[model samples]
Target: MLWPREAGKFIASKARDVKINMEGVRKVAKVIADAVQEGKMDVKEFKQNEVLPINKGLTTAQLADWMFLINTLNFNFWTPDGVPKFSIEYEGKIHTGYLAMVACVNRAIDEGKKMYDPHYYSKLTLDDIKHIFRSDTPSTMPLFDERVRVMGEVGTKLIEKFDGSFINILKQVSGSAMKLVELVISEFPCFCDVAEYEGQKVAIFKRVQILAADLWMLFHGEGLANFTDIDQLTMFADYRVPQAMAYFGALEYSDSLHQRMVKEELFKSGDREEVEIRGCSIHGTELIVEETKHVMAERGMDVVGINSISVDYFLWDYRLNNAKELEKIPYHRVRCIFY
Candidate 1:
């Protein structure tokens, strides 16, 4: 089995439906490199991005457990076409997509629910989820049953094996992000976000990596959250990031595939086209990071905290900020718990 980085390159090499444009990769990288050199983009920006929930009065351990629970149910927030996106109203602002998911959790907490505690959520039922995650809009969160099941699975495991706190699991990593990622995948079967393509097992592990990234950002890389190998995490291969790459011209789909995507045709989780798009997105991001480093080197500027996760955060935020400009590009859709 190939892990995400190697699997990405291998799948991109053999891809038939998706292609990576090296020139476009360098093009975006140059833009990002300039931002980094000018101090416009870095880890600080990631932590302070408006999309993230405010962290004023929350404790680190509470924040850690919240992130763990959120990432567990983070998959499949994309709504069907023409639906008002699953949204939530909080603090006089409306949030959609991933932000809405985060808001719903915070709202539940404010309503006196111990949402961050595994013991509380592990016993929740389907009706409980519907009420807690009740949308401000007409559209409900997708995969509701699966979300409840995943919550129970991970929450129960934490109670039984990790002393009822995700912080215990983090303690076992000893400041290694990769080990934490591995432990998350090994200990919780719901987090094993892997698939098979052309007779080889490929691990995308999107939510697991995002879990680590969220924890690291939440703690500002201090205390139990410091991870030496945090850079090993690749860009999460999701629908939106690929759209950003395509908008920048870094990723290109075949005419057939592009037409299918434009038509909003849903692909199964492990379809060849889906795998190629996701894998190529990962490899394409690695190229972007490399080119950014090269450009930074040429300018003699040592941009601190330049890595795949940081770049991923930048690109993801770029997509959110430029959603209007990127609507021309179609994103591949796969309604699975893995992405």
Candidate 2:
């Protein structure tokens, strides 16, 4: 929640003060410009002195922050401190860029510096890394053949550097939801599926292709939105996405749970169909029916076909307070009942 509005105003003001130190930057730029005017800098000298780090188009506050962070990696990174406000790689690279800038300056101070061509340098991408690593030393096989399929989350920038379709498969959603499951099979890791028997649950999932983690989360959530219908489940079962490291969360079932899913009732009277539970029960709670089918068959349902939706899944919550904390998912009831 926002803290009384005034707190937000104060924070914004404090941030603005540190954003741009205009005066300090003018002093630095003038010193470099003066040296150039005196002919103390050659074309090569000017390149390092003016073009390299100094000409990278960084703002004054950015340059100052970079200087301060490299000197001492401490600054406002988060609000009220829970998770660190900075990414580890980003934070580490901050220091690396700072050191590089300092080294460039030192180089400019000596040997009159050297020339720089913007066209000569570019950021490396994953494909470049693959190519570089493969060609770096003599190798009989390409790097792609030598290593595991995934080399961590290679940056999209790196993928672009190499100019290949390594990431094309993941570019968009598949034509059908089933196609997505197939793609997941071909691409990502699957945590759980019907293929390998997992002790987590005894029953088979209707969907063949799915990310185990996704199914796990969906089942635990017990919501119709996540679980989907049989048609959608068919999509997930077709191919294999690699299994992930862990199940989505802790959820379990008794083999006997599916046992309660027997046909409830079946009745046919003239033009209509009726299904009665016969003597079905839910937690020992009996069904209350006023009229018996023996008297008037049309008025009462003697039996009905059991449905996938009728099979209710339950989670045990011993404590009352946390019981409502959990969500209840209705199984294949509504449409599944008639189908």
Candidate 3:
């Protein structure tokens, strides 16, 4: 039987089936790079030592080229380890602590698919990218056929789910239907100079702060990140890991950060169907599951709590049993399966 953590592994949601492949992205990059190499493009603008990718309108092709030139990558939220992490000059002091895992996955259309998986490891590999644009594109691909028909009825359902957002983009990219409705949203802005299909210039690099805020909010709402007094999310309810987390950054491994989030969900709450932490905020640190917040609070720590997949455990305990947190968070993520 598949538990929530186990269930997450089963999630591909046809994400693998839809969207433009990495090879296509790579090809686009190569085309731009070739232009730059032949002096057909201006080096003064695109070069990393002098400028940022934002100015060039970093066209879709240029974005792929950036993968090779710059240390940053979209879709995969990875930061170099052991570097000055995230150092911003605050109050004239360079305060650097844990670097925020800066990663982006472009979920373009919003078909209301379940974006978070409770259990997922492994990264999307180069092979996965190659497969996306291979000759054998799927049947429902908008590229192959004007009509997008996936999973039998899903394509139709998706059409009604917000039909217009992705149709043309998929047609431009390939005949394939997007795995989910949103197609490459986060990844695109990093590379392309999206001017509102037409507005003023606000590239993703220039708007990292905005991007971060969006992600932080989404992760918190999803059951990936949380403030809890129970196990983060054990296989069992009300008996799991302590702390809150919807997902963690898997940028080091794959194109999509969503997958890592799934596994992180398990890690945060999978121990003994109780408190299970994949590792810890500290890599070498380890803990036992049965440990309870009550036990920790006796030592004057109210921060500890088991993670429950449900809010029945959270709302009751989070405000009362835990910190004197006054911030009002009303809605909660309702977990349900997605096609």
**True-structure RMSD, every candidate:** 1.6, 29.5, 22.8
lDDT of 3 by residue, 1-339 (tens): 222222222221112311222333333233333433455433232211122223334343333222211111212211222222332332233322111111111110012211111011012234432232122112111111111111112222323443422223323433211211123333332222111101122111112221222222223322311222122222211111112121111101223323433334322212212111111111100111122233334445332222222221222233233322422211111111110
lDDT of 2 by residue, 1-339 (tens): 111122212222332111112232233223323433455423232111221244444443333222211111111111111222222121123211212333433233233321121111123344543432222112212223212122222222223532322123223332233444454334422211221111121112212222222222222323221333322231111100000000101111122321322221222211111011100111111110111112123434232311111111111101111223321311111111011
Top of the candidates by TM-score: 1
| Ordered list by lDDT, greatest first | 1, 3, 2
lDDT value, residue 259 of candidate 3: 47
Off by over 4 Å in 3: 4-289, 292-295, 303-339
Cα error of candidate 1 at position 43, Å = 2.4
Query: Which tens-of-lDDT digit does each residue in 223-328 have in candidate 1?
Result: 9998988889888888988999999999999999999999999999989999999999999999999889989999998856778788788888888878789888
- Candidate 1: regions farther than 4 A off: 47-57
For candidate 2, the per-residue lDDT at 324 reads 32
